[model samples]
Target: MLAQIRSIDSNFGRTNGGLNQNLDSLPENEINVKLSGKTKYTDYKIISHKNDTTIVDTTLTIQKEYKFNFLRKDNFELLAFHNQGQTFNNLAYDFTNISQFPDIGFKAKLFNYFDIEDVNYYQVPTPTTEIMYRTGLEQGQVVDALFTTNFSKRFNLAIAYKGLRSLGAYRRSLASTGNFRVSFKYETPKGQYAIRGHAVNQDFFNQENGGLTATSLEAFVNDDPNFSGNRGRMDINLNDAENTFDAKRLYFEHTFKLLSSKDSLQEREFSNLKLGHSFIRDSKFYRFNQGTATTDIFGDANSSGSINNKTSYLLYNNQLFIDFNSKYVLGRFRVKSDLSTYSYGYENLQNNTVGITKNKLKGDAVSFGADWNGRIGNFYVNASGSITPGIGRLSGNRLFGEAFYKKDSVLTIKGRVGISNKSPNFNFLLHQSTYNDYNWENNFAQIGTHTLGGVIESKWGNISVDITNINNYTYFNENSKPVQFSGDVNYLKAKVSKEFILGKFALDNTLMYQKVASGNSVFRVPEFVTRNTLYYTDEWFKGKPLLVQIGATFKYFSKYNANAYNPLLAEFTLQNDTEIGYPTVDLFFNARVRRTRIYFKADNISSFALDKNYFSAPNYPYRDFVIRFGVVWNWFI
Candidate 1:
């Protein structure tokens, strides 16, 4: 199925893919078929859908998802919710996977509350099934399953589900999430008509233990000589605070050919004109509960500890699109236009207990946008733009363009820039938390961002740099309150990665540098972050069927005041006074036997032998020293 276009109006929609593995490169067999067939098309594997001849760049290489590359690549950065789950890092360097839709410029996001790694769309060639399960120290757990089958050469169906439960290393910090998706694709034998659809449901539950309430940080950071290892003995801010966010979505789209052409010599046919329609319905709900211990209030004068607040939002969107493809001066060219309308906002809400004066935000808009992709020999370029004039007080937009060149497999260089103006997510704009330390609705302003970046890659290693400027930046402040800045903010980031090899020994290193040029008072980032892995790998056993590698990675971040996570709001907000830094090292051994992958790991190895202040967020401590083992197996049924 083609990668369906995600709308900004859809609650629980996807995010930007900057830190994700580059999905632009097609599989070897697919690339051969595309060039030989003299035609190009888009599929679900990549984040974007295209219909022109574009070279798939395979030069971008990413390390395995199991390791820690500043948490963006880690399997279980925070409490796991599969891949792309929540992570505790500075907001300035946080990786976003969600992209804004060209339609009504609005989104209902709970990114920190739930994560769905694979994006739930792919081409299933045959009947296949996969089952995964993992359990960690301190009552941590995970379970997942997937099944796909081809009913016919032109039709396929897939269903996937994931469940997670983690009683965090600290007391009263349990988190659980459940996600399920069902997808289907069908195309006519002539490839003139096609249809794709999917239904998804995701739910997240977390206990809001408001970090440590101790006045002095040392009370929780240091360990006494006689103290045994019991994490529950530490004091926490709030134990009764709990929150849950849930999303349900049903989507369907179909397209048909309006004009067609065929080549006599090559026995090839193409659709020069096509029309399509799509429908999506998404519903979201956030609930928070607190008991008696919350009576004595803090943080705000109008709030108390014991409270109950819950709210729900329902959205419906319909879209129509036209696509054209042919040869033009710019090379093989394709352009597409879309028109969409949406109805969204809260249908029902609780009282002042939720902290917002308005119960619902409802509006509709007519949005249109276009995209073009072309290639001339080895050089290629693509551009896209979208806008809305604001129908009844609702408006937002996006503009993006990029170009790249690659010389065979040895080296590649690319650069891109984009500008977008998006309204803050509905969840943050109106949050209803029970904790006295968490509750908000201050009428946040819209956010505009301008970003420019470049990448250089080769067999030896890769280097990347980015410069971003933000207007009206939005975030949670030190008081754990949601707010927006009116001043322009600038962020500079650069990354370098390389590996040294000698015989069977290899050392992989990655270093990142970040700086806040304008709004340094609110925009915070670590000056330096580094990760190094030292390991040995070789083949052993009969016929060398088993391949094993053992290694240890030292992860370090320069001392900085990392933003703290608020469970009630499901966001990482600024914490100017909460300075924390420590080295977190992990030791692991992994092996691949046939198609199965297995690993045994010791997380936070250094913490087991020394007394150091190691915090994942401001007051929350990193996972205690623990031993873990897990395996992944894929099957074709």
Candidate 2:
């Protein structure tokens, strides 16, 4: 089946996951061949919320190695904790993607949360299955399985589940998580009407040790030989504490064409007039539990012996839109209006030493937006804007525009601009907890941000640069309280990536540079970060049945004041005390046989030679030398 798919991919007319196909590239006989008997690589499609589609990629490359971790995304700008399912420390920040409304802000525990846009629909000619497995820290593992198929040409369904559990290498650093999702897409034979929807349930739990104690921190830094072999013997600040974040979501959208064009040629200039309706309901719960609260560690609590605090958030959104194509508009234009209702906070009011805090924050907002996509000469332009009028909790405005220019497959250039104004995350405005020091209610001003960025992609390399400016930025201070910065924050980030291949030897390098031109005391980031890999790849055996890759990747970042993690609130706080900087190396051996790709890795190999000074954050040591293996396999029927 794998060989047949490859053959069809090479012989048939292909598209870049778009509606248009260049039949001129294929021979007459190839076009006349019956395509229903075999499934081409392009036949398996993944569609995003924005209607962009891309085929499932099965090639084994270094880029795949970078995304094979717990989050299944590139972590070039993040530093992971000791465990797989735990949270990550940010090495850089991006403000280009702005939200119009405030969020339930337990940002730390939300790393594993699957948002509505993250869910994807699928269309396939045959049943497809993919399984991904990887070994975890000590006692557990991570596995993600997916199955999707089309019952008919116009209907499709997909189901996927990802679960993880790891005991970790430290005393109280275990993580467990599960994510389940189901999605379906259907349309009429003439494509005048269509519907797509997805439902998701996800939960993330972590055993919080409150990091290491003063003694353990000193011992680990000094490389105490007594406890070098068994890290679990080290003492921590808290022994019996855990936090969990879970969410449930249901979303669906349907569209129908009120009028359609009869001529195929005229469809390019004028097409179907579509009226669409979308609805979403999302609810989330967060809880923290501690068997015993140490007053010295977390201060006085409502119940010192045992503590439990919970918070909930629920949101409902309904949007109605209309889209059409006309010669005057060039391509397509859409106008939409939506109403959103949100409730976030505790259910009951709390009166503590600090004061009395409100029980919840609830409100509704009506928003309007427009989107346009068109082509002028050799340039393609896309723009969108949205606004929520009146003074409400969710009042905001956003304007974004992008332009792209492509020259065959050799080079491409893209530029973007964005400006937004919105309130900070909900937690910053209102929060109540069992710990006296964790309770607060404040009214902070809106945060305003402007971003300008551009990217250049060519055979030589890929380069991107972004500059962002912010006003009234909000963050958690050293005291773990929300505070808005009084001064402007200016940040710039630039990155470059290139790959060089000579025969079986290849070199891939990615470098990033960050600068805080202003607000240095409030905003912190490493000045330099880099990753370099040198690998060798070749086919082995008689008929080149097995493809193999061997590589070593080295990653490093400059020392800076990295933030500290607070388990009680599941958030990172500003700290000026500890600066973390380190260099680590990973060795990997990967092989691909047909539809199965196997991976073997020696993670943090440099830890064996270098000093044990690496830390993900203050009092949180990075992972030690470890060997792990995993495989990703796919099947088509």
Candidate 3:
């Protein structure tokens, strides 16, 4: 008989375009296998678009995914898995632009492990898991091919072609990446030597124009015929009215390492050294053409336009490290120290013909750091610090230290503190030029700032808090004048979590609070949110597995000055002062059967509606009462 159960998992519930939850688990000495598949239906309607009256039609989407996996296996074992997903929207708009040409990609891996005896080793397992190991060389390959019509538009289309070879795993062994690399090592009685190299290339392109809004003569008048001399004639003449862009990147790297060790009566230790260098270059071009003009409410005339921008960037980096370990007092007390240095330089250039703007940015930086760890009796301490100097330096100096004490099985205490400085990026300093007659600039008064935080943990539970400030601790001049702003412009956060078990049932709870102080009246921190969940597992129907879980979340936002920026509205100056309604609550339930899992989730179960404080794009609406149901399955061979 096969066990089938309903399982519920916790998630942040924040839709940020990435996987919703962390899936990595500690290594175990068990052969676990899973196979699952799922299909889902989604209905989306644009409720409001920044006060716009143009109602976006409703659309429905259908999607599916399949996956499989095998874990913690011995030598000669095999694990294989694949995922396929498709989405269909009613708007005649292939959600994935299959007509414009889309592509399918896959990756696979196979490895054999061997153990060496008669070799002395020191192992330190992680507190969360009993596994003690480091990542090393692993071999794999990836292949991708796109169909010509995958992303086809009515007037244009695009296709992608690429392949990659991979070798050697990094700290997070299972992470997906596109670099092919090799490593070699030589050892002797006196010391050890090692070298490594990596190279990778990727290319992509797409052309889409069908379904675009019609262009008008007013938009054509703003077009720049002589945008750039280096651009090909075809690029300059392309309609590009549909806002399209394509890009590609290539990377290469090389590294070296050497170590030495010896034994003595007072202390026995090993000193290891490592060095690495890498060079990379990237280029990208995007074009957006406007073919129409639209009028706005305030009698302001807005014309449709297109833009083409290209940028090329290059980077060089070097790193060196040394490690030393020693023991004294009959091998009771142990000490370990490590030091590293890194330096990097980068240059970038961006050219835009639509705005007739050419921008160049260059910067170089260097950083050095050292860490020391000591263990005496049942107490252990670790300390580290680093300083970085550079033109666009985001972080100048950073220091972190931690201490942990364990007294048998009775209790354990752990604490850590850290402080650091940061600098702003080029985009924050350089303004964008959209139209020939339109120019905007960032009015930032500060270059960078600092942050400090600490954490404490014990068997009972764990708690952490951090505070960060930008421009409050430092000051800089903009446009030959000292700029000043109101508000502390700082952020504070705290979190705590613990787990409990009751017979066959398990419960976990976590609490978090965050607040951001200072900033322009138009920008404010999101409301405070809290979530709770309960889970139960039981055997049913002759040992068939059964699990059920349910959860709920609540969000509260204090009425603040909603009209702080409006010159005509003086009644409300702060968000907290506004007369807002009650908080919102959401509920969800999930179940699983072997490799198959299902989810039933609802957002804003109370049917509450509110405007979002932030906007990623114009004419985008915020929605409430979003209900979703999904299922997934996996298979392995």
Candidate 4:
């Protein structure tokens, strides 16, 4: 089957290849008779913003199971709420994957937002379609569908949409979201000119009940007999509150080769010089609505009748770069310059008695950067840095570098270091809301961060460790106000993963350890987190037409101070009164038929047997025992 095409170099989804490798076991005639004669999996390519290419993977493995969720990614470091499309409590943080500039800061809603890197372009030998469907919390379902086709050998087009709607078990806990994307890529036959672009629109809506009330939380935590059967009767803090977030973006990049070698077969010290340009326009809106304000919970509000607040952010960016190759540089180097214009704020100026007067923050920034990629035998070096001039909100500097050593396909090692200095998110700098306690304007210094990390991947196991130090860290305190820490924060994180197989049974384990060397009062995380899965795999029937996998996963974490979700601000705030930690068990049965994979899961089965003390946050109870079914299907035409 064409579905069995495999890429030569693959680590999960990220791949690199200039050559194609076929499945030798398949008969020669079977492969030649396929459409386009491109039967290898590598022929179906997915390209990232950085132009890294990976093939569509149809194999069913334990890693695949971990990624089968609403996010469609492994959420090992996140604790999900009771329903999908809702906010998550962070279990860990990665300082290395930070943006160079500040952004519109409704972080809780950004989880479902698709960034430039999250969007992918595709090239396939035939028209290909993928559909993912899954059951939701109570009253809805989720469907993500994508279709791509190639009109010619050098041009491709793709469209995708993911939508979800669910009415959760808790009162007023309903979530609905939709994301739409269209992407295309084109190249000239001579490999001298190429272009790629994409357009995306996404919207998120959630009905917020503000979690359970004090009595309700006590009853749920104590497993009171009256509330044991039905959680709907529990009292909540808010009855008619909801929030929505919407975003739209358009992006394009084009490149042209100014000079090239005449001979394709001959190796040269200096070969190619290319010029490229990229442009992006993005806009975002966030709105909160409530029928009535909860004065006791959120303090006094400007208007007691109802609350309606909205914030808008707009950005335009243009970048130009030149790339060249030379023997002195070893591989390739790119030097670039960028100009960006941004605006973030509310519609009307707020001149309250509290002295918060600004309606918006608008400015333009100019930055210059360079990137280098070099290889010496099996060792590779990649480094990049950028600096923005002037004392504007977006003015900052960032430097990152990584070195990799690969020993055949058996083992690989990588080391990385990063340093960044940037202002906090826009919301921290200036925000205006109907609630008196929510309005703020402050002049804060740029936050500085430094991170050092290393990773080793091999057949025996996988290990990664990172140490990060931060100065002028910013956070929302228990009072729900943005505040910068006066002290430095140092953190260390380490993770190890391994899988042991014995015949048809396998046991996979992942363990993570985290520590706050300082600044624990403001920065908090659990000391230990773990997930272990034990599964049995086998083929069924005489022809082995079906492959089956049955497994149970055990996950747990130590008790620590977890942040609380605030629907009004679409953010998480510090909470020290309640410590949250729990263990959960999930059972799954999966099967693969042709290019389709089916999934059935019993989530949080431990809730039916253990104490009812599990909480996703301070007052948000974890999901109870629920059975969910889903399927992922891919078809090639």
Candidate 5:
């Protein structure tokens, strides 16, 4: 049998009457407790019974926390216990439970219906002039609508409307009428103010058998049998007529913003004030007829009767204008100014069926300008001039100048000069009533122009050149008569663009060259043109999202013949006479979400065929295939 025991206890006391017993036993591998030399674990036990050599005490406490798991790789254990002379102070343990993460997703989604703070959309497709006898799709469709608001951050508001319609084939007409525009704005920290108003009412209609057709009649070889018994006969016929036109306009505007600033010796500065007013009214009407002919009548061959020539027209134009502008800077000088004043009145009317009212025509004009800019370090300068005055026309002057040299990141050099005067157009100076009974008078034409230029820009590219007389060296005949053809127009232009980065894609390449002058050719010039673009961007496809752009365009024009006269009896002709080269290619796509945006575009992808020659309509081939879809949304409240 075997037994092993070890115990130890110590006590020294002084008391009276207290039972106590003391015992100590040790020996389990020679129990030892030599403090400070590091020897522990003396298998132990202690007992004490005393009387007069006694001790009296009381103690009770309990505290327990145990979490232990250590069965290998990287252990962790904690055990605590206190009971029996419990003494434990200020002890703590906290290891805030670990493990969390999951959330990163959103490709596209967020457009919870209607709240497009401010939006303005515009579309203009002006192509309508096919009324020789009307058959379908003849120019007339103008639409615009605008909406705006900001009711509480300094009040602002806007509302606009415009509509026009016309589709013809014999009759599907409602020509010009519809308009409403309104605006009000007020913002101030020291700037911005606006008040605008507009109103328009227009109705114009013309259909009196709509133009030209009178089969036969021609006589004039000194014919006079006492005025030919046909009452002062001077005959030529073939015309069918119908006409109506009407108009009305009213406008008012007030704008002001005085002194906006940015300075470091003037980076930018502005001052503005505008005031306006307008009112206009116009009217026109015509009806004339005389046709029922198949004659051999010195008197009568089969005598058919129908001859009526009626006339009606009423016209008026009243205009008023007052405009002013300003810009500022000082200390390297920069200044600009503009002024305007106009008042006009005109009236003409003839209503015959014996209701007599006639008073033919009248006139007006006045204008002004000023400009300046300066710098002397990298050399920069500009100067300007202007004047215009009229009553019966011709009182004009204009002058301009420029000089430049810049080098901050390499080269720039420039030069410019100009002189000008021009006037003509009051319906070529009113001479009315003709159905081929010829009557014309009142013609005035004036023009004087000159220009010279130069430019060179670089970071590595740009060049421009010019020379002009532009219809002023000579060529006159609006009754000033004397035309044998004179010419002088010269232009040479060059352009280049470059930017490259290929890994994440961003590239732009452009080249353009235009040269004209070898007997003057410049009417929609496109001697050569080129373009290229490739772009890509990303930031997680939404918010700071993706973008892509692709491009291609190439055009070369040498087709010439928008003749002012005799490009084959030209009343404006350019319906193919050989030399033509027009090319076009384009594609665009855009998308975004989290504020919504989408766009897609395609334009004349080599379907290029446009033979537009309109000096007032007709010579058409601007084919079509245009589709547009749009959406944009943004709002915060």
Candidate 6:
């Protein structure tokens, strides 16, 4: 009885579940359920049997007046969605598709490995489901689905699936991909321990038509003005080639408090001594197959090597970290150790009469790393470094640091610098293509790169600049053979995005300028690229219940000798002959009604009307002028 009196006297006693039995049970036993439906009604004055005035109300009449820009998806990350410098079906902002293969690099040759953008999984209390469907070029279609739910406040699970199938607009061009992911997050009620994990499997199958034949490309450019209209009739270099990239991965990270925070009961803070462990097991397979083998097209085709080539890679990694975070200047610090084993290359061949041993690699490496990050007032800084100790030939060493300052949403700035010295992909060192067009065994030195970049953003717009220097930049030359540049190459790139809104009209523009300060002979980049949009927005009706927006986008890039793509190698190779550049125009109208959004767009509106050249990749023409319609509906069920 005395305890009850003490608890009742305090306002927080209701939440303490102390001696108040009735209050404690009542709070926990109550359940919440909700549902909603809407309808709209119109009233007419009977003057000429037409409605004169319109009024919208939430209680009496539901209004379908929600409105949004049709080009909302093209707002900021437009560069990525555009895939400006890549082949069709490729991701954007991936102009440089070249990177050192992972230490355990075994996978089917890939053109879009660096292009895939993984999902950002989140843990939430409410259940969420999102479904999207889209049409492709010809017989293409995209379907996506994701679902996340929390069984308890401290635990949640999520699953996501995606399927893409595109027959493409050209002959013998097609792609089919399936991606599945499952993830879970858990935390202790006391917030002392937590774990997050995800497992993903992706299968990408692409038909390698080897693009169109040279004569066909010539006809497309000069001989035939309406070539794009009959894209299905174009002659291709190789029609039987197909590449499949398959991968599976499992990752998990868990952290447990080593020392409890002093305010653990009253409040929770991540600042404390903690121990963490992470594990990863990943594998990849890449295979290229051709039904009718032809040695004539690819030099080594008929030479005892069937037109089937495959590669596989496996990796197992484990990491441990001891971390400390404190409010007192120590901010946060982490000491980490990693051990990984990798196996790559072909295990067995269907036929290897070439008298060559199976090109294979297997190794183990151990690395040590440390990192620190802290925030002081309006400024924040972070730094990290790692080094490998004679575990494998690959030098897994890296150093990076960055600082950021932000006063409010209006003024924000960030600068970062980093360098990585790493070995080339094992596949790059010893590659065997069943097709004779490409075959090599390179003994190249490890490459290193230094990068300095900064970004500034404000209410007006944002700007970013970067400077990069690469020693021994690796790339495929005109000969379709992988080569490393001996000298250092320097590149400077800057991008700016500015938007002006006056009354109901708005204009947005983004421009990128790139320069090769040195080693122009080896490095390549366009001089300039830009995208601009002009739009107007307004609302109608007495209640302004209906909103509408219409806009048009313009994209342009300077003419340059864009790299040619080799389907067999899944690589973009240097080409000096053809320079591709042209301006593209698109018009769009988008609207939101209630919670639903609909968009209509006409891409490449001036295609045949203009002789401008538009190609996603060499010999691969861009999509012709076409109109598309799409809708997005969100449900909170």
Per TM-score, the best of the predicted structures is 4
Ranking by lDDT: 4, 2, 6, 1, 5, 3
Residues 1-637 of candidate 1: C-alpha lDDT, one tens digit per residue: 1112221101111122222122244434322222224333232122222211122221112244243221223532222221222344542353221245322111212433222233344443445565555664468667677777768756778887777777765667776777888877677887668887778898877777777766434654556432336666767778787777788888877777777676567755432666778787777777666774453433442343465666666666676776665444442222333344444334444435554666566666666777665556556566667776663333667888767776655666777888887776665565544344444455556678888888887778889888888888876677666678879999998889888999988898888888889988788777887888888888789897677878888877787777766655556777776776667788888776654656677878898776657776776766667777666565644
**Candidate 5 minimal-lDDT segment of 10 residues:** 60-69
- lDDT of model 5 at position 356: 24
Q: Which of the numbered candidates is closest to the native, going by highest lDDT?
A: 4
Tell how far residue 69 is off in model 6, in angstroms. 16
Instruction: Residues 1-637, candidate 6: write the lDDT tens digits.
Output: 0001111101000011111111111121111213224211211000000001111111100011111111112332222112111233221232222332254333223333322224333433346555555556667566667677768856778787877776767766677877788877677887678777778888877777776688888887773856646777878888788877888888877888778556567574545677889898888887878877755555656345347888788888898998787677545777999888888777664335444455777778888998776678767777778887673555557887778787656677888887777787776776766554455566678778788888887887889888888898887788777889989988888899888889988887889888888877767667888888888777667775555668888888777777776666666678888777778888877665544445677878978577736776676777777766655554434
Per-residue error (Å), model 1, residue 348: 5.6
Which residue ranges in model 5 land beyond 4 Å of their true spot?
1-375, 389-392, 395-403, 407-410, 413-422, 425-456, 463-523, 527-637
Q: Against the hidden true structure, what lDDT does model 6 obtain?
A: 0.62
Which pairs clash inside model 1? 14-98, 15-97, 15-98, 15-99, 16-97, 16-98, 294-305, 294-306
**Where's the lowest-lDDT run of ten residues in candidate 6?**
43-52
Task: Give the per-residue lDDT digits (tens) of candidate 4, residues 1-637.
Answer: 1222333211111123211112223223221215645366457777766555556766678877998999998899999999998989999999987898999998999898999988888888888898999999988999999999999978999999999999998889999999999999888987678888899999999999999999998899788989877788899999999999999999998888887664445653255788889999999999989898888878878776888889999999999998876655576778899999999998896436567878999999999999886778778777889999899999999999888887765677889999999999999998887788889998999999999999888889989999999999999999999999999999999999999999999999999999999999999899999999999999899888788999999999999999998888899999989898889999999998877899999999999889888888888998989999999988878
Candidate 4: which pairs clash? Answer: 5-40, 5-41, 6-41
Q: Write the per-residue lDDT of candidate 3 for residues 1-637, one digit (tens) a residue.
A: 0111111110100011110111222122111332133211110011110111111111111101011111112111111111001000110000110110001100011011011110111111110011111111233333332221111111111122223222311111122222111111122223233221222232222121121122311122233244212112212112332222232333322323344345655453433334433333333332333343222211122234434333233334444444443344211111222122222111322224334233544455556666565567767666666666553433366666566665643455665555545443233333233333222223344333344555555557767666665553221222211133444556666667665668755555556565666653423433343333445545345556433445554544333222221001001123333332235555656554543445556755654443332111111111235454544332212
Per residue, candidate 5 scores C-alpha lDDT tens digits across 1-637 of 0011221111101011111111123223222223234323231111111112211111100000000000001101111011100011101111111001000100000011011111211111111010001111234444444454545434445455444443322221223333344444333444354333333443333222211112211121133243323321322222232222233333333334433345447664333333323222222222222344223211122224443322222222222322233334311222222232222112332212222233343333344545454445667666656565554443466776667776653576877777776543222233222221111233344545566766676656556565655453222232222232345544455556554666756555556555556434322244555555555534444454443333332333333332221100001222233232344444545444433334444544454343321111111122222333333332211
lDDT for model 3: 0.30
The C-alpha local distance difference test score for the whole of candidate 2 amounts to: 0.84
Predict model 5's lDDT versus the native. Answer: 0.31
Off by over 4 Å in 1: 1-62, 65-87, 91-98, 101-118, 215-217, 225-228, 263-271, 293-306, 329-357, 391-393, 432-444
**Comparison by lDDT, 4 against 6, better one:** 4
The alpha-carbon lDDT assigned to residue 353 of candidate 6 equals 47
